[model samples]
Target: DAGITQSPRHKVTETGTPVTLRCHQTENHRYMYWYRQDPGHGLRLIHYSYGVKDTDKGEVSDGYSVSRSKTEDFLLTLESATSSQTSVYFCAISLRVFDTEAFFGQGTRLTVV
Candidate 1:
């Protein structure tokens, strides 16, 4: 199984503040992804990087950005947090083909008020 972990498993923040969440992987996978899981919405991709310095926005990329400077680390940043952004964020790593299942971290619970 792939090894992946996320930092700041739980966080609470005020509106208009900036927050960063970190993801680290030991599997040396070629693809990394950040997603948010909300009730009734399933998991929506926030951002993903195929390779170092090569990232692209996902369906819900607004109010969020990501960076992957090294193969082992990926970071997600919220420039200005908001209540609507409060949700559980997950990090995943995939080296397998598209049909194969990816591995996910425990997740980070973020709450904004």
Candidate 2:
């Protein structure tokens, strides 16, 4: 989401628990994306939505799910968290048609035990 960063900037959870992260935007951007950051990987896309109910999986979509029911909100869900899923997550908003750079959230750090 634009302006606001990912919620719960830091979290730790046990393995196998369901986790939901939220992103909200004030600017009605057309494109929203979820991504994970890991050492050596920089950032890997998890999922993206161009409009409400219109979503597509990204490069690292496995074990993760996303939903966007409103223009200002996008959600990422981890059905069963694993150690491999412990990473910094980011939400980004883009205009798509314009040349402007995407606006990124501050990021959320999720640690699974």
lDDT of 2 at 49: 95
Candidate 1 regions off by >4 Å? none
Scanning candidate 1 in windows of ten residues, the lowest lDDT window is 93-102
Over the stretch 1-20, how does candidate 1's per-residue lDDT look in tens digits? 56898999999999999999
C-alpha lDDT (0 to 100) for residue 57 of candidate 2: 97
Compose the digit string of candidate 2's lDDT tens values, residues 1-99. Answer: 247557979999999999999999888888999999999999999999999999999999999999999998999999999999999999999878368
Which candidate number maximizes lDDT?
1
Model 1 gets an lDDT of 0.95
Which structure among the candidates has the greatest TM-score?
A: 1
What TM-score would each prediction reach against the true structure?
A: 0.96, 0.94
Q: Any residue pairs clashing in model 1, and if so which? A: none
